[model samples]
Target: MSVIVLDKLTKDFKNGRGVFDVSISVKRGECYGFLGPNGAGKSTTMRHLMGFYQPQSGSATIDGLNCWRDQKQLQSKIGYLPGEIAFPVDMTGKNYIRMIAKMRGMKDLSYEKELEDFFEINPASELRRMSKGMKQKVGIILAFMHKPELLLLDEPSSGLDPLMQSKFIELMERFKKAGTTILLSSHMFEEVERTCDRIGIIKNGRMIQEINATELRHSRLKTFELECEEEADLNKLLVQFPKMLYDRQTRIVRISVPDSRINELIAALSVCRLRYLKEEKHTLEEYFMQFYGGKSNV
Candidate 1:
């Protein structure tokens, strides 16, 4: 069953840009990755799902409860980590977590020890003195301490060190094993590729594609470099595969073809005295680029 569902969800701001007719579903016990570049409506979509902002049209729901209408009840079943960590700097890390626990009506402090041991968070450190990474660890602890059924994480690892990031992934795996649903929103392609079961790519407030990670890897475009015995017939080849990009003067050719055509290309190349034939499979970055015109540094 779907843990979360967005049906034609549309949210418009005064400036007139937000998620446009966005529709998607996340299944139970699956890590759903929502990916896009900056200003690509990622955060807006998340806000709609979390009931922070009501959509102008359409609807969003969690566990069949209307997100905007049943927000209070939904909050009890889900934990959220926003992209930015805003806290009372005067409070110590331990105090902040305890306050959150109290707000959620959870009395047990047992989870605190486990979280501190795993994240290495210093309970006594003041929020003002903690590094950005350390503050992020506190946010993670608060989100997971209650053991909610669903986790809504928006760039949950934005500030952590490499070691801590690795630990965060391990923690996510543990959550999945325990039948928790996770919705991870981020621009980091590598992190999404590692942790997500299925990913949805959005561009200009519209969802361009949604595919399983394994299927995307299998169907990724492969780039091949072919050097023919003599000057190759670039014109003929270009017509056959219009997507091919070539440089004839250097006798170097680059082309990205679907997996289905790989065997055919190899068979045709076998006839020529091939100097080098390399396959370049698309990474999550490249797959993201396909929808966003091209990759952006941001």
Candidate 2:
């Protein structure tokens, strides 16, 4: 059975800004990446999934149960890490974790202690005095301590350093290997590409694209950048490759073509003397640009 499902889920706010008709599905042991710019309804959709907000229309389900109606049951089965956290202003991290554990009816905290050690979080300090990174670590440890079957992480790596981000990815990989289903939302392409099986791109509160991670990695489309020995060489190449991006002053031409047309591109470049010819590294950034609007970038 699909572990997570959103069927035409719609939530409209009073200001006419909200998610509309968004649908997605995630299977057991699969990691689904949810990506969108800031205020593009990413957080709104997550909130609905977590049963924090009731959907005005449509539905969200996890393990064949309604997210809103069966939230109590769902909460135990899933662990959620929100984009922003609200910690008690005066409570120390040690006390706060203890309080949560007590509320959760946890008698044995061996695993939770392991999480604290794993993340290098110092639970002795007060929450207000903790750095952003330390707080984020605390959040991550709390989310994973329960060892839930499904994870709903919204910008899980926010405020984390690059080394810690890499650790987060490794932790996720371990979870994946253990047959955990995850729905991770983030704007970081590298992190998403590294951990997710499929990526769903949202724009203006609607889904704009769904791409397979492996297919993206081995895509037929490739971009190349070339610097000609002379301006004439560049001009000659431009005539043959009309679709190319070129700068006359710099004598540089950039073009994207399918792998099958590499011979054609090579043929066109052969007639021109090239100063430097190299294939540009293609990242998910360019792939995401088509769906990313300028109004809000998150």
Winning candidate number (TM-score): 2
Cα lDDT of model 2 by residue, 124-240, tens digit: 899999999999988887788788899999999999999999999989999999999999999888888788999998887888788898788777578899888798887777677
lDDT of each: 0.83, 0.87
Count steric clashes of candidate 2.
1
Q: Give the per-residue lDDT digits (tens) of candidate 1, residues 1-298.
A: 9999999999776465788899999999999999876777888888887898888899999999999889998998898998887899799998888888888999887987798899887778899999899889999998898998999999998898888988988888888899999999886777788778999888778888888987877777778877654565555556666777777776667777778998877765665565676766456886577666655322
Off by over 4 Å in 1: 220-282, 294-298
Q: TM-score of predicted model 2?
A: 0.79
Pairs of colliding residues, candidate 1: none
- Candidate 1 Cα deviation (angstroms), residue 154: 0.3
lDDT for model 2, on a 0 to 1 scale?
0.87
Count of backbone clashes for each model? 0, 1
TM-score of 1: 0.77
Tell me the TM-score of each prediction against the true structure. Answer: 0.77, 0.79
Each model's Cα RMSD: 5.6, 4.6
